[model samples]
Target: MKKEFMKNSLYVMIIICVIGFIIIFSSGAIGKSMQYNYLQKYENAVPSNQLERYLNDITSNFRTAGQVISTLGGFGILLCGYAHYKEL
Candidate 1:
């Protein structure tokens, strides 16, 4: 029963990792589109330099989030793989 639980947990971790991978792949384009929309919405209200900086910061934050997610997923997958190997 414990072994079955462990195996199931590992499978769940793998699925989460795949979801993280998908987020990492999609975030960039999503960020770009969001940034563009934000800029367009505030075209005249904000100065170009300030708006650009803000948009850059937003994009950077999104990228950082993606990186962190990817790192966690990678680590989780690696740990599960090691556990599986050791079990065998």
Candidate 2:
């Protein structure tokens, strides 16, 4: 039972890591697209409206969330490794 639990936990951690990476990559792509659109519309001018500022803030938050989730997933993987080693 314990072994099964450990195995499942490891799988979950791996999934989490994959999801985090995906989120990070998607957020970066979104940011780049946003920049492209802004430049096309405004020609290098900074975001001036509240909606634009809000969108930037949301993008920043997504990046932060991705980083945090990835870090947590990495730590979880390491912890699982340590536990598996101790069991052996």
Candidate 3:
């Protein structure tokens, strides 16, 4: 039962890690696209309007979320590795 649990935990951690990676990459791509569009529209100026600021905030939030999720996933993966080692 314990071995089965450990195996399931490891699988869950791996899925988390994969999801984290996907989020990180997708957020980066989305952010870059947003920046590009903003730059094209505003010509290198910082966000000065409410809408622009809102868009910027959204991008920032996505990046922050991705970073947090990835970090958590990394830690979870590390913990799973440690558990596996201990079980062996």
Put down candidate 1 lDDT per residue, 1-88, tens digits, no spaces: 7679777877777777777677667766767787778777877576778766766777677767777777777787788778878888
Model 1, C-alpha of 41: deviation from truth (Å): 6.8
Better of 2 and 3 by TM-score: 2
Off by over 4 Å in 2: 29-51
In candidate 3, list every pair of residues with a backbone clash: none
Which model scores highest in lDDT? 2
Task: Compose the digit string of candidate 3's lDDT tens values, residues 19-57.
Answer: 777776777567667767777786767655754665667
Candidate 3, residue 62: Cα displacement in angstroms equals: 1.0
Compute the lDDT of residue 67 as modeled in candidate 1: 74
Model 2 C-alpha lDDT per residue in residues 1-88, reported as the tens digit of each score: 9988988999899889878888887885777577667667766666557446746766787788888898889999999989999999
RMSD of each candidate? 2.4, 4.7, 5.0
The whole-model lDDT of each prediction reads 0.75, 0.80, 0.75
Which stretches of model 1 miss by more than 4 angstroms? 32-43
Q: Which ten residues in a row have the lowest lDDT in candidate 2?
A: 46-55
Q: TM-score: which is higher, 1 or 3? A: 1
